[model samples]
Target chain A: MDVFLQTLVAGILKGGLYALIGIGMTLIMGVMGIINLAHGQLMMVAMYITYVLHLAGVDPYISLFVAMPALFLLGCLIQRFLLNPLLKVDTILPENQVLMTVGIGMVLTEIIRFIFKSDYKSVSTGYSNATFFLGNISFSIALGISFIIAIAFTVAMFFFLIKTDIGRSIRATAQDKDAAVLMGVNTGRITIITFGLGSGLVAAAGCLLAPVYYVFPDIGGPFTARAFIITILGGLGSTVGAIFGGVTLGLAESFGATYISMDYENIIGMTIFVLVLLFLPGGFKRLTKI
Target chain B: MLKVDAIDVFYGDLQVLWGSSFEVREKEIVVLVGANGAGKSTTLKTISGLLRPKAGTIVFDGVRLDRLPADRIIGHGVVHVPEARRLFREMSVEENMVMGSLAPEARKKRRETLAWVYELFPRMKERRKQAAGTLSGGEQQMCAIGRGLMALPRLLMFDEPSLGLAPILVEDVFNIVKRINKEGVTVLLVEQNVRQTLALCDRAYVLENGSVVLQGTGKELLADPHVKEAYLGL
Candidate 1:
């Protein structure tokens, strides 16, 4: 029973990080309708940035400021130069966006690997392994910090979308591009900004995960899979849905790993994803606030 | 003043507007009446910079506006309240209005313009916090127009604001158009509802199959034989 509780607690903490990562992916897709296959690669780049900053004697938390804006600008430029042209009309077929993004992802990964090498890197924070106990379940300080930061970022993003003028334009463009332009919204600019903001969030996630997850040039693949699964499970374009979906998946994985063979955890997760797609194509729409 | 002088717009290989010339003098309401595909909406789209004319130009306040992007066009005091009441449906009514004043210059005037928009559509003030998607069709139309008004347009172009509204609501909307004009905002209205459109404008243009087939004062166009037969249904 104690073991089960411990696993459950661990899963919930991990789920918070998943939510942090999934927020960017979900926002980019839901609002922009663009599946950024390069998203995982962007996160990988962010992790590399964090590693470099740590090597230079900067704290991971402080590195977030540099990484977020830098990644944001990179995202904006990528959308403006590479993705924007592809977005207009379908040069590629329906499923080709994924392939195109995958190609771009490979390029980004190779470049990062060439610059930084493919060796494993991890952040050694001051409270890297410190933990707090609540009864029999123990939670690491890093996990707790990640969870708090993730929730705060999510709330801030929500407030920005609902409260600001520019935020309204972003939401409007997301819903109806033509209409938004008609109303004098520079949708092209909005698209670029959305891309920047999405990648910026991913940078923060990268900084958070550097201490916990093993980072490497090709480490984005499994992270990409996790992000894709969480996004789909939460429904495309829903931030709150991403959080709920991430937590649910984390719990399921934790329980499955304990009761069943740990090796079959991937199978169980994939099965739930498939079932969700089959049953609820919209993905937890009832749970969405608006 | 908004002048679309002999402009030709094409959708790829197909010509959508041919030598389409019209003018809306400051503070006057000009109506474009036509069938579904007569290019009324396309004309609005071209003027708003959504569709660039392959040939000719658009001038507002004696300045060429043909080269500017849609959002930049709003800075020139020409705003388009598109067809279908394209309010940011998921967002609140207030947010939709705020989005209208997106240009950096317009942001300076937002508070005053917002006050005017709310004054124009008082019901919107009551439902300001409500999601625009849930508003009634007539209310949504009001929200859409109110949003355009938030830009403080010198010339407000409305494409079928009467669409999907009750007859009484249509009358109310046209009355608001007249009121907006009287308040010194020039109006260019496009509508399939020929009778109501004719009843509301100083001048009218009849477009057919992407060309301006007839042009006259509102009363003249209203009494023309072709307009009477095809548009007025008399």
Candidate 2:
């Protein structure tokens, strides 16, 4: 029972960071109706940024503000210059956009490899290995701080979507493009802004993970797969569902790593993904109706 | 006032409107009556800047609207309540209305306009917190129209506002349109419900095969022998 409780606590903490990453991907998916294959690459870029800042004596947590806004601008540029132009292209398959993102992921990986030479890099602060105990469960200090920050960001995002004017416009565009236009929403601009917001959120996750996870050029590929699974399990465009999906994946991975062979960690995630696809086709969003 | 002058609109190689021309004078209830595939909806879309005209221009008030984008057109007070309601399904009825007032000009007056819209359709007020997709068809139509009113439109256009409603609900919808027009908003309505729309509108235009074939006062067109044969089934 103690072991089980410990695993659960660790899973929930890791899940909070996963939720941040999933939210970014889901936001881009909801507004643009395209899977961003380069999403993990964007986070990888932020991790590198955080690592460099840490080497320069800046704290990893403080690097978040710099990494977020920088990635936000980068995201806007990609959407405006790369993605928006494709809307007018005459293509046989609409999957051209998805393919473009895959190419983008490759390009980003190669560029980072050229700069960093594929070395596994990590940022280590004083609290990176520090732990605290609550009854029988121990929690890593860094992960606990990350979890609290993630919850704060999620609550902030909810208020933004529900209370603000531009946030409502984003929801409107996701619902119906034509109706959004009729309602005076500048949808093209909204797409650019949504992409930026998505990137910023993922950048936050990357900064939070920098001290815990190794950063490398090719690290994006596995994280991309994980993000995709979370989005699919949560229902493609539902934000609330993404949170639930992330937590479920985190718990599954945690339990699998402990009870089963550690080598099967990813396999466990894949198995859950397949089962969810077969049984809950619409994902948790269908059940929650959000 | 709105003017569509000899516009030709196309979807790729297929032309939907050829040399289509019409006008809606200030504060007038103007109806464009035609069958499916007659380009009635296409005309509304063109005026709203959803589809650009291949050749020709659209003028709303004194401003040329043909070059403006779909979103910019709404800022000029030309609101198109599109076919099928097209309510944001996941959003609440109030949120849908709030979206309608997103433009800079409309945003300042949103509160007063929202109050007026709720007065026009009290049913919408009761369902304000409900998701628009869950509403009945008649209630959805009411919400759609209420949303348009929230934009503070000087020229309000409706595309088949009563398409799928029962007869009694259709009557209620038309009555609301009439009430809206009486409140000083110019209306350009597209409908296949010929007799009733003609009875309510001040002037009417008959469209066939993407072109305007006839135009006159509502009473004049209602009495025309050709209209009676082709449309009224007399």
Candidate 3:
């Protein structure tokens, strides 16, 4: 029972950070109706930013603010210059925008490889190995802090989406672009902002993971696959579903690792994805509506 | 004041509007009544800047609306209430209304405008907290109109406002349009319900296969021999 409880706590903590990455990708997907394949590459960029800043004596947490806004502007430029222009082009495939993201992911990865030399790098603070004990379980202090900060950011995001005018416009644009335009929303501007918001969010998750995880150009591929799995499991374009999807994936992986084999963890995730696709086709969105 | 001058619109390689032109002066409830696929919706969509004309201009109060994007046209006080009541499905009724009040001045009077909208559509007020997708078709139409009103539009356009509603709800929609028209907002309505909309509108234009085949006052078109046989089924 103690082992089970310990696994549950750790899974939830890890899940919180996963939710941050999922939310960003989901936001971009929701508004644009296209999978942003470069999502994890964007996060990888932020991790490198954090890694560089950490070497300069900046805390990973402090560098979060800097990485987030920086990635936001980058995201805005990418959407405005790259993605939005695709809407006017008479491409052979409607999925040209989606394929463009794959190109973007490759470019981003190659650029990082050129700069960082394909080396595995990790950031370690003084408290990297610190732990806190409660009852019969122990929690890593850094993971706990990351979890709390992730939760804080999640709550802030919900508030922004629900209460702010720009947030409302984003939702409106996501729901129906034509209606949003008729309602006087600058949907073009909203799309750019939403992409920025999505990038900024993933940057937060990247910074949070930098202290405990390895940073490399190729790490993005696996995380990108993981992000999409979570998105599919939760339901495409559902932010609330992303939280449930992230936590479910987290718990499944942790339990699979502890009970079965470490190799089976990803297999277990794939099983969950198949089950979700078969049984709950709309993801949790069909059940939760919002 | 709005002027659409010999505009030609297309959907990809197919032309949908061929030299379609019309005018709506301030405070007039103008109606464009046509058969299915007669380009009524396309005309409204063009006027609202959703679709740009290939070789003509849409000038509203001397500003070239065809030169602007759909979103920018809204800022110029031209709001298009789209067909099928395209309310933000995940958002609440009130949130949908709030989305409409995006202009600076509209944002300031959002509270008052919301109150007025709710007053006009009490059904919307009762379900203000409900997600818009869950509403019935008639209720959705009302919510769509209410949302359009929240924009405080100078020239409000409705595309098939009574498309899929019960007879009584259709009457309610016409009455709402009439009531709003009396309150100093010019309206351009697209509808297939030829008889009632002609009765309700100040002036009517008949569109046939992407061209304006007839134009006159509501009573004049209602009595025209060609309109009587082709549309009113009289």
Evaluated with lDDT, which candidate comes out highest? 2
Residue-wise lDDT of candidate 1 within A1-290, one digit each (tens)? Answer: 89988888878877887787787888778656867788888899999999998999998878988999999999899878877777666453865556767887899899988998888878888888889888977888887888788778878988887788777778788888888887777888888898899899888888888887788999887677777888888888777788877787888887889889798777777888899899987777555754
The estimated TM-scores of all candidates read 0.95, 0.99, 0.97
lDDT of 2 by residue, A231-284 (tens): 999999999999998899999999999899789989988999999999999999
Q: Which CAPRI quality tier does the interface of model 3 achieve?
A: high
Q: CA shift at A208, candidate 1, in angstroms?
A: 0.7
Please name the candidate that would achieve the greatest TM-score relative to the true structure.
2
Error of 3 at B174 (Å): 0.9
Global lDDT scores for all candidate models: 0.85, 0.93, 0.91
Q: What does candidate 3 score in Cα RMSD to the true structure? A: 1.3
DockQ each candidate and list the results. Answer: 0.73, 0.91, 0.82
With candidate 2 superimposed using the best TM-score fit, by how many Å does residue A44's alpha carbon deviate from the native? 0.4
Measured with C-alpha atoms, the lDDT of residue A261 in candidate 2 is 74
CA lDDT, candidate 3, residue A234 = 78
Which stretch of 10 consecutive residues in model 1 chain B shows the poorest summed lDDT? B98-107
**Cand. 3 Cα-lDDT:** 0.91
Q: What is the total number of backbone clashes in candidate 2?
A: 0
Higher-DockQ candidate among 1 and 2?
2
Question: Which candidate model has the greater TM-score, 1 or 2?
Answer: 2
Itemize residue pairs with steric clashes in candidate 2.
none
